[model samples]
Target: MTNTLTDETSVVLANDPHWWRQATVYQIYPRSFADANGDGIGDLVGITSRIPYLAELGVDAVWLSPFYPSALADGGYDVDDYRDVDPKLGTLADFDVMIAALHASGIRLIVDIVPNHSSNRHVWFQEALASPRGSAARDRYIFRDGEVPDGTEPPSDWQAMFGGSAWEPVDDGQFYLHLFAPEQPDFNWANREVRDDFLTTLRFWADRGVDGFRVDVAHALAKDLTYPLRSHAELEEMKLVTDGSHPLWDREELDEIYAEWRAVFDEYDPPRIAVAEAWVEPSRRHRYAAPTSLGQAFNFDLLLANFDAGEFRAIIDHNIQSVSTTGSSNTWVFSNHDVVRHPTRYGLPDDPNRENAISKRWLLHGGPASQLDAERGLRRARAATLLMLALPGSAYLYQGEELGLPEVADIPDADRQDPTFFRSPGVDVGRDGCRVPLPWTATGSSFGFGAAGAHLPQPAGWGSFSVETEDADASSTLNLYRRALWLRRDLQDAEELTWHAHPSGSDKVLWFERPGGWHSVTNFGDAPVELPDGEVLVTSAPLIGGALPAAATAWLRRQAR
Candidate 1:
């Protein structure tokens, strides 16, 4: 690498108002990140203690997954309070300290905000339960009268996004809509009271010094008042509707709601910002990231792509062009709290017999884990990281991927808590595997996650991927990330991408150049390829025989800016 990295390099772009556009944001799932209390779970104090580690990795921001009060029905997304922290996670005082610690480290904190639904334990939902039907207390949530003579059945055939029916029946013959678990009741955005409460929630966090927000289930906030009856297949097709006619998502009313959010965000001196976690179609996603709205949308097309050059190339080009119209940067993610880890996913065989591209199934026993090419998987994953970081948009890293940690994939059913697992009746194992506590030390009861055993089981080989081990080895994935992130600061000046020419016209090899002479070359094929002519800055793997090996990526610089 031509440039030497210093601590000051991380804060060079801190003055930019749209700092998130080309930033590296790391997602920390609080319950599994670190446990300062040693109670078999992670907490706010744990996250605050790790600020130096995050700063060393060079992430511009840290997106903390929900630490709010909850019964853990849906992995903390089932928020019980919008204004305070969960006692198990930490108290409000601890949260305030964590915010200060992150900011002092030059790392902005983006808290998770769940607007579409709230825990059934929330005061408003409990009030809806205590009050009679049609009362003002019941107006804040989506409660409707059941159809048919008996009123025992739900209002419609709608199903939950996790599993089972979306509508749950109450004792009074009234049914409330919950697009997710029954424990999380959907808010009726049409209600003035519901809208007003969320506005207050935004201001509350902003006042607490949160730099921004990562809005959860952003697309489902507004639903069709007239719940239409349709099969699951028909609902999937409706995602492509350009007119926002989907019964449960992407309604036209979302623009107005986000505009209100943006107004509150702009009230801050640096201007608080937000990124939407909407899974709408690519063409329709720009609306969520418009200047007047959240200002950024997660582009998950990379998560759907297999280990191939053509797929990655197409997705990169299409996403850049798609989001360019809005003048907002696209957010690229491969793994998150909700899905399988990318290394394990890339380890699977390339075939149609595998789970469908949309929703793949990973079993805890006798399933996809039985057949895994971990070596090739980690190789491809590292290569993918260079590709993602060198792109024209922002990049997001899941909690443990910096150490190249593979999916646990074998957590016992008895310890599982994901609603997806229980709701699906064990046919699907849910996300417990990927949520295992991080290994901080090579020798510990729970790999330094906590004094007690992790709430989710960790594998016997957990120590092999511990932070202590990775930190010692120069060739470790952790080093690759630390080095790559430092080099990535130079790539931020250019926002448009241009594909580089490959001497041999092979689709399996991808070579692209950004506007500032920063070129990234990736070889997804099973053969070594000659390196392009330039000074080698960084590479995913060591060069063999003066050529880039298979499943590796290299960043070459023709000249400095």
Candidate 2:
């Protein structure tokens, strides 16, 4: 629980400029993390109060989801004001105090920066709406004239990510573009004033002692400006294309913007850093972390991969190789606020379109998965966690994953708040299931999350996974995470990873060794496997008669030959 890093890790951190290359960061969804002042919403003070818990959790840094002034239209991704804190969350003074406390705990803070778009309520957006179509104010956003003289049709046929027309009509007969939700209007980054404003916003936080930022929608900032319509097939392929012709995403011009931001980052002491939430192809993903841009980007291939050894190994290898030339480190993530909790996903029966099925129907009424699937999911989730943590490079852990929390798939339709659900209406249930408030105590009005009701309902059975309940049991997922994190402190920042040959020569089992005599093995086959000749550091499940059980992972200190 001590804040001090081990001597070995400390030495590496002191000498290496890129300390984040192997750092373990914990992602916090602010509203769901903890609630203070009985307001039914989490705030800066709530986060400040939990620093001790985070320090004890053994994370090097905490990446908070957006807490800026917002309407909560897209879980705060629709930012209204970049320079100030939301009154509901707390004042800027509270944020300063929280930053100091986290630094005091030896944990860094990374705030979310939503640069691609601003809330419709943002002052700039308001001015743009009130101004003429060709006025200077309108130039700050992507406002354009309609295709027809009557202005009945949209300017283009681009579709929104949340399932609607990307363009929203205004009173002036012009339309503005918003790739996600209509509440969030995409900024015209080509405008000098918009660029200057964001730079000022960055400096504002850096001067306040905030460590870094996680740039939201980092790949979509720069648009091609041609306003071309894409075919349905082309739209589908855009998500995975590299050096693609897609006009709205992963455009080459984004690198210039990142370089400009990186220059601003270098002006401060210790040099602030950024991580991108980009969904570029494996070949081009590293550009966001090029030497002159943000230093790291989230690698979501691991999250999307099926629970198979070959798929995982292929993703790991491809990711590690992708960033090798950029001097940027690879980032691994399993579950996040946007995706279904991995436990629930892993427990479902495999389908050719498993990802799509899980995405659209995991939380729907009469969905495929059941309670029995949940038990199997938890087992695989535990094994996946150990395997992910044991891998090389940086890793990100979502807020409640340590408690083995499953997606609250049965949330009532009336209680759902995600914009995606509202936009699509019954087609996509959205992300509210994964964003439910955390349960800190075994019993409380809202499981100790708040004195009042939570914004999203916590399932009745969540008390079983509460911090208090898990902390009392050594075999609990919470303790497993603590033990793994503490043991991982000894792991060196080595780039080399060699896959070990399975004794049975089966593809279901995976074995790999790090350069410093650290080894990790996972069993996905139907039966248990004999442990290699090494001192077992940690195992996801209890070993049976000296053999590791199926759906289990073990980390070990390899014995000398």
Candidate 3:
């Protein structure tokens, strides 16, 4: 099979052997992107409308969050059917249009595959429940007898992500275990039928022309069959619940299943991608992303690593080293639909409260900080983006991240749709705070994301922080993102990422030298430090030393010597 490489060598490399490793992906939470049919919800058409925006963003692929048929129990995570699009989101024809538009824009599409579980309302589940006994349909799920038996308590003291036990008791003398919600019954991967069912779904989408998938909880698909639940005395309850106790994760059975899937992918003239949403430690995440396993798994090093200067540098360096160890391909993403927006997590400076000054800077361009403050934060974000693009692994962009979007602090409980919030609701769970509909128009209601009174709220003030407004303003963050993306694409060397640590007295700065002689420098903290003594190629930093004005990020390139 002599595959002809594209002018962009990386694209060819991505399309070859294992395409996902080298692919650049942009994630779109369909409900919040852009509503084209005035349904108060962003649908496939909405995503199709913004294909140009994504094309300009320079991403090789777009990862659409689940828009499948569902009961909306877990904000679509608990899928009812993998075969069709959710009516609220769009029709099957609409999805075909989206795929066509993306392909026209030179972008591939990867849909979310929630194989770990399904909505209780799913037909399969209904069938299983009706025939809980020795029925072929019952073989699809893990149906066991007795209360997940524990020593005078529930089995394994494992807590559900939403709170309570990971198991829910069923009336039929047997119980079904759900790692997430009672409504989401875990599929018994041990069953051949279950494995075949998922593989069939994979073929269904591939035949439909999807680029691939960002598999939901790939690691969670398998579990520890031992059924050994931890004792109640564990320090943190969550620790006992999620620490690799499932019966299906990383099981040899799973590895073999992947090998089968890999064979299927190989049959296609061009390889199909399968990126696992494995979000554990660096080492474990690697296991799922090995050559024969998932092509690429999500990287959490940039998101969950220590905030200390030395720690950050080591983390980045370690990630590069880790991928090298795999001798296969890999991917990286700092933020996604599942986590809080980076600016907020990166700790941007909050604005002083003012009665009349509520215009939406906080949600769109970030909070109302001073020019230095804004510049500092913007630079930090850019530096991060630069590092992401310059790394050996593929990078993922959550929607609105390029425009330096920050998390919204106040979404009403009624409007929240994330399953993470439904579980342990306190300081907000997962990333609903950052998952609001995108703002595409300055003067239109809901930023023109949808008709007024939509399911999701647009930022409080949409007249300013919108795509229409930012497109006209040269200095707008949206334009800056476009510039960076275009520059990356124009520079052939950008695809061949080459990185080296710069000489900084402190570990705060993570310096990278890209293929086209571009350098990116970053101080991950709120306090400013002196820039290294190199040609200040490009920097988003405001000042050399002082309070970094919070969320400040910058880029610098060394002059040709």
Candidate 4:
């Protein structure tokens, strides 16, 4: 494979049967990507219009966050119809057209599948509400009689992932479980109809030319039948339990479900695939990524790592080892719709408990306290991007990361829409900051995101980081991404990564070499470091006196010894 970019077309490497292994995937949050109709919202047409930009970005595939028909509860994660597109997004016909456009541009399309739950407005859920407590319709969901005779209390005290009780009472007096929002009811995967429906849904999309599916909350589909009561202390500990011992999450039953889904995916000519959004422990992740189940599971350790070289190297090594056991590729990700942008996170002071602080109200405020030096953050983010791309597996890039977009932490409360925010009020800032609409132009009503209003507010200074601004600058983050991705094609089939030891034995810099003399060095310390003897190909920042600057990364082709 040779790195080549011609007329905005990426030409490199023959296709591998396991293309996802070492593939660069870009995630598009539909409503925030682009708006072609100027309807104050982004739609399928908005994405279709940007297919050229995506191909130009040099990504192998584009994974769309749920654009399915929904009540906008949980940002479309609460799906109402699995087979159709949301009218606000576009019709099913529009989705088909977009699929064709993406494939035409040498890109694969991956859509999100929220199998764990459905909108309360879904027909099955509505029927469950209308039917008697013990009726067949009610059986499709986790409906149980209330704890007391009056049925006033929920079946058991369980907390929703967003906030509040997991159980919602209906007029029929039976309580149903929803691990997320009340509008998003958890389905009874135990029901034969529920399991079969998901298989059909998989086929529906696979038949439409979608290359893959990003299964939302993939580990939460199957729950313990007993619905055991868990104490507050146990609940807190459950969040960190990766052993799958928790009653509700990472249950063994999920493996069977994925196997069935994989079977459906295998029916296709090229064979479709799925990636699990499972948050289970690293040791248990292989079950989800096994060849018989989902082909890949997102390795979020990188997302949770602090801006330290040692921490990142450890995470990378562990993820690669874990995924290898399953004969699957390690899926690396830095930022996604659910968390704060990596640039902002890297800028903030490192706290040992930062993971737990993600949902805290003070962190969500997105105030001065929530931010640090912006320039420093961008430098580290750029370096991180290079490090991620140089690794030997699939990398998921959130939409605006290429442009070095920061979190819009100051989104006004009234305009906030994440269920996590409303569920807890001012206590938790929610995920809206990272979900703000993207900017294409340096100046516009919504930074050219739409003709007029955008669903979420865009910060005033965001224009400076817009694509138009970065695209013109040769040294901009956007260009770095473009060049790195173009170069990445040559390393796609690389299966080994050997860490290079610094002569000074410093832990502040990460050095690694791949096959074909491709080496990457990233400096996470305060001082500059000497680069290995090689031809410098590209860098996250300019070299200072031939030394890799602090918070910078340099890719090189090793000189013959």
TM-score of each: 0.95, 0.95, 0.83, 0.95
Global Cα lDDT for candidate 4: 0.86
lDDT, candidate 4, 1-561, per-residue tens:
121123333233223458788889999999999999999889999999999999999999999999988889899898888889999999988998898788778888889999888999899998988888778898889998887667799987888889999999888677899999999988999999999998888877877777799989998888875745776467677777766677788988887888898888777645677899988888888998999999899988888878888789888888878877899998888899998888887777776763732643365374655357778878999999899899998999999999999878888889999999999976788898888999999998999899976899998898899999999999999999999999998755567898988766889989998988899999999999999888898999999999999999999998545
The TM-score between candidate 1 and the true structure equals 0.95
lDDT value, candidate 1, whole model: 0.86
As a TM-score, model 3 comes out at 0.83
Spell out the clash pairs found in candidate 1.
Answer: none
Tens digits of per-residue lDDT for model 1 on 1-561? 011213353254254587888989999999999999989999999998888999999898999999999999999989899898999999999988887777767788888999999999999999999999999989899998887787888877777978998888888999998999999999989898898889899888888777789999899999876644666678877768888888788889999999999998888756788999988878889998898999998998888888888778888888888887998998999898888788887877764443433355543345665678888889999999888898888898999999999887766778889998899875677888789999999988999999987988888999989899999999999999999998897667768888866887777889988877888999998899998889899999999987999999999988744
Clashes of 4: 1
After superposition, candidate 1 runs with Cα above 4 Å error: 1-15, 227-237, 351-358, 363-365
Question: Candidate 2: where is the Cα deviation over 4 Å?
Answer: 1-16, 227-241, 353-364, 368-372
